[model samples]
Target: MIAGDPAATGRPGLLGSVWPFWVLFSAIYLMLRWPFVATGRFIDPDDELRLVQMRDLLAGQSWFDLHQYRIDPPGGVVMHWSRLVDAPLAAVQLLLRPLLGPALAEQIATVIVPLGTFAVILFLLSRLAARLVDRDLAGYCAVIAGVSFPLASQVLPTRIDHHGWQIAAALAALLGLVDRAPRRGGALAGLSIAVGMAISLELLPIAALFGAVLLLQALRGAEGRERIGAFLLAVWAGSVTAFALTRGTDLTNYCDAVSPVYLAAMTIVCAAGSSTAVFPRLTMPAYLLILAASGGLALAAIAAINPQCLAGPFSSLDPLLGTLWYDRVAEGRPLFTMNGVLVTQWLVPPLMGLGAALVLWRRASGADRALWLDYALVLAGTVLLGVVVTRSMALAAAFAAVPVAWLVRDAAQNLPKRRGIGQWAMSLAVPVLAIMPALPAQFALTGVEALSAAPAKATAGAQPRAGNAPLQAQDLAAIGNLPRATIFATFDIGPTLLRTTHHSVVATGHHRGAVPMRDVMVAFIADPAAARHIVVRHKARYVILAPDLPEISNYREFAPRGLAVRLADGEIPDWLVPVPSATTARVKTFAVRY
Candidate 1:
């Protein structure tokens, strides 16, 4: 029922409805092309690590101790993440590699992740919109809003990561809730929650928040008893099923292993009594609050008891007791680190406020209001908790469009009741207005304009082969040749480097244990001896340093005093006492050395 036949509905022809999808798709496609088009970009955060992990998987690596050929001060092999994120992409690439070869396999896999992810998100969002709004309009809006949103521009066309998959699962969870059949909804919700938890534990709080809202909403309806019972049963079944699927082969054995938090959630749901007793009080705000609190407590308790459950078995250290916890707390001390409050948190709630007002102003029934509020709260909570920076915030920000659309619908309804032209213009305007704020940041990050201007920079640094190799041009070309080379690169270039090439990088994006490696990277930047030692130890063939990368601005500042100083002097530092030049093999952009 969720994915109906597009043609059979007597809706407009594919050509008629296709433009919205096309517009959104083209925008996303262009956004994806921007970094590749510009200075030959790379993702500095987690992309490199993921690529190495995939590489290892393709090379027949084990699932348990996912390893990377790290090139940081720590150098050589190190354990990074579990198989959950990398394995899926690796498997797809592996399948394609035999037929299409490794390069093509990688290309295919990266493309599929985003395309597949968008398809799944679109399908689920479409289902939810259909149930809440009209079926036809819902389908149109899901495609329209989903494609045009800046969030799509941000996530897709980068390397494949768990975050995009998480968004898809989140959409699925919402779809499950909105589905007409409670049983099916429950199962889907359970699965969605489990899969989403596996991808990013940051979403756990949001999941909990959502589950609580549903329970409270169920309690208030006329058939509240049955609704509440169904929802509780679904939550219990879903969690237990998830635990069973992940923990081991045996399903029955998971009972004894069920964490105390799970037990508490079950206990709370049971205490809520049958739908008969709970349903009559559904309209009271106090009842809703209590239900939501209880459900949230259940999730938090589980999280507290077994922190690993949220983000899967392989995870960064627990944020509370782990070293990273203290580091993050110290780093984010300006805000309440203990509470996990992030500063850029204000953006989401205000958007949600606008969405909420629009929802109310639309004169949507109580059920619609409740549903919107529930989704809004969970998403807002996730942002306030500082789970991630832009992507998650964008996910939450995207909901603002839904409410805005309804407001547009009301406006269109009131206008001279125009036929074709006015309605189309109004619909186009709503999404554009909703997504305007993210435009500048999106363009800047993607470097659409900067790409056009790169010719001048290339010309400025023409052929200054001071230190055996031209620093600027080769650095530009090195990223494109990365997949075939083992390179020592700054962390800022790590992600995009991984996405573009096959090279193994040292350290990327801060994880709990990466501080030591980062310190070593710092030493490499500050002291040439340390830098040489890092390069020599890793057997790295190439060294990549990007001055424009903002995250490694500290490293960037040291570039002039460190690497650039050596480049200017034409003297290899004593640490690299016997530095070798590219003697035998030289490519147009980069020199190949062993």
Candidate 2:
């Protein structure tokens, strides 16, 4: 019998061992990611920008100077990212620099750090699963997590973005929630949430859910009160430390990024938790009343101080930005609207996992039942988030692996002992089903043909043509060799320009660079005369266009008679002198004549 089986006796089965499976998974991940590492193809704009940040750090930029001066010139755009992610990356690069030199050391460090994060995530998932089910089942869950497409993609080579770290923080919080030891668990969960918030506000929904769970627990009794109090203290401490260490003297910016406002809010919440812990003997009704009062006062104080934040960080976003840029971001779209393959890959495992979790919850009792309920809540919340935004699918899939592993293990164990072909096929089917959804959709579609046919319909960026290769470093190197000047380029190619060349960019995909992004959008979509005026006013020396980029479609649709449209149609204006490059140049560059 499998280790988790209720009827099993004696020693655990094959899947019970954790380290063997972890080693195997790590090997597989490295093998799969090695190709991308060799190519140095940083998949997303965020990853490329991370390398730029690291380079800046190594080049003697101040630790608190998060500004990319190359992007907006004299007064650079202040990045919304925290320096927490940079520490380890820069450390690894520094450690290896003596042996591998600068370039090679950076490449190896970039590959290793993300994969190392993947390993940590797997261990956390295993530990979380072990609490919910048996050790064997936990191992299976680790395997499922290892294979999860969305989760794995985020930590793949050169994907040094903060998304993977956010997911790790989320899982760490989950582990804390399920721990039997109240104080330690509460502290862990609180610290994880605080770290996640410090990284990015993307985890705000999950963080809220965690906060709600703690509140509910506290309402139950004194033990809950203790846990909640511990949680609050940890959050307060972690947030303050993270802020002080990362933001340094620039602590007043309370807009998009985490700032003094968040610190104040956390302090208020911590005070409430401390008060509850102090009066643990209070009646249920009185406790509830105190909680309500504390929450009301906190919200009131926050609103009074930063009324603009009540509208959310993106409240100040221009309508044109909402319509043109954010609306086009694939991850922000709902699950149903995403590509069929992604929908299949993302939705299936979670749905099955949820089903498995429900089954287990129904059978459980006492402490087990409570644990299962907590796990179920997390899974359910993530699934709901996935439905709302496609990006949350990764988190959903990671959590889903817990229960789905149980389902796979249980099914495999129940198979007949006979060595017939049917039995073998049935045994194999359990894991296969757990890994992928019904294969009818996956098998029916042709490889690149189907993806290409529905390029615009696909999530994220437009799909490249079947035979076409992506733009490489060499392609951007030529443009980088030109005179040091701000290059006006699409958001997708901006980071590449920054990485491959010494030139600065007008705008990237980051929302914090909204003003420059808006200017770029307006110039691209406006008439030639207006475009020239904006370009000259910004002192943009060169304009670079990657005509085949997915964002180009937005430019064409939004402004039919705009400069970008005319340029794409081979009507280069006299004022914009075309800079000659190799015939094979994937990007076209033009000198912006005043």
Candidate 3:
């Protein structure tokens, strides 16, 4: 580093150390995310709902009541989300609302909260990258984190969902894995997983993988035993506290979220694991016996608390819903099942990262080799997990960032010594492809297709997407003027409808609303009379069809004579009276004439 480099010394204060990352990340992210910030648009339905969740919390909804009362009316669906996620968002909104007024405050909250999360992720990754390679590459790590689509997408502006938090927790776990202090590292890994699990049980698999890695280390010696023991104790302690504070008096053991059942299971693991550290350094065989018995004991406790959970959350999902809705969620599906181009884009960064990990492991020696080997195994396992569950790829991408950065640095530093132009080009291409695997390929393919389709494009007139913007905007304005009432709508429209107006929706794409979602899906695919009966059953006063009505195309196809198709064709049933149009609002709103 140069003598006067502020970032290199990190001398000013806490923020000074990470200010370079913050400024770099913000500059890159804001330019890229300017469109969403300008329009106050949310990237995902989940983010819209997260805003609703934050609003409710700030509006004085009980902390323990995780119900979206607007979702199913009288008997609302109980959300599996924890209050921990809602806290920071509410705080931000509360802080800004008085100054900017309610509307502007909300828009700012969405942007600020996620951008804050983005900065944290970069700082953590840069520190990890610095340890793995060089402190000089910390800025490079920040740049890559902001520019990398997989990592950036999770925490970009208006992305208030918990996915970013989960990624941060996973990085914390990775740091814990490599930390020198056995107890602190284990505690960091354990508590971070606990927090992640409290937010979403998606972390369950990560917790298991981490637990296994820690357990394997325990077999080596006493330092290893302390690490494993601290992990179990910390997880057990952390999960218990989170459950009590968040769940309150709600005692019904839920399979979908962390409940007493999980805490009980943790108790068994903690007690057994802690014993290994208390006693004299035991034989590997002794540790094996204890671990085996602990698993059995935990399973037995789970059976006592809620045996049904053993089958997992999706076990009880209605078969029809699974076929129509759950099966079609692209992000939730395996990598191979996704579009080839999309799969390649997501696979490249992490695969390159794993390759780097293998290189780092091979080149290292002594304890460093063992550390890199551990990193390699975890990275490889996470990559495999991402292959099976595609959204997990984001976490894998974040994990891969350090090694990928290190690899890029190694290549760049060796560039001056290279003999050929071909070598120079290859070295240059490594970082480009590493950061954006799909863009070049996508651009090339798009260019080829554009040339081939030029005549068709010239004849077809225009695309609907640009046209959709104003129609959706005007519909939101119109709906916002109406009286608050429950509206029966398609799955994708539910979240935004709730956000933009003082309206309630029967259901959204959220799985916790499974029962109501089932009824809604059935109505969409049923005969007009049947659909009317279902709509009236929910006590909904209106039905909204999004501009494209693209969300329920499955309903239109599965039942050709279904309500979704009838509505799309302007074949309104007698029971539905057309709401007055402010403009040619393609997202049709129908008032139920019950």
Provide the TM-score for each candidate, comma-separated: 0.64, 0.91, 0.94
lDDT tens per residue, model 3, 1-594: 111122332433434445777776777777887887787676678888888887888888998988998898977878888888888888887888889988888888877888888877877776675555556666667666766777788888888899999999888888788765789889988888888898899989999999888877776677778988888888899888888889998988888888888888889989999888888567788888998899999999988878889999888899988988898887788999976678778899889989988888888775567667777778888889999998999888888887887778778888898888999999888887787788877888888887777564454566555332322567688877778899998887788888878889999998888889999999988898999999999999988876465565777668878898888778889999988762244677888997
- State the displacement of the C-alpha of residue 368, model 3, in Å, after optimal TM-score superposition: 1.2
Error of 3 at 583 (Å): 7.6
**Every model: Cα RMSD to truth:** 8.6, 4.5, 3.1
User: Clashing pairs in model 3?
Assistant: none
List candidate 2 stretches off by more than 4 Å: 1-16, 417-429, 447-469
Error of model 1, residue 562, in angstroms: 7.6
Q: What are the per-residue Cα lDDT tens digits for candidate 1 across 105-130?
A: 77667666666666655555555545
- Model 2: lDDT of residue 114: 85
Candidate 1 lDDT score relative to the true structure: 0.51
> lDDT tens string, model 2, 364-473?
88666766767777788889998998888898988888788888877777776638898788778767866876465667766557666954667776565422234676
Give all candidates' CA lDDT scores.
0.51, 0.79, 0.81
| Cα TM-score of candidate 2 | 0.91
Q: Counting only residues 3 or more apart in sequence or on different chains, how many pairs clash (N, Cα, C under 3 Å) in candidate 3?
A: 0
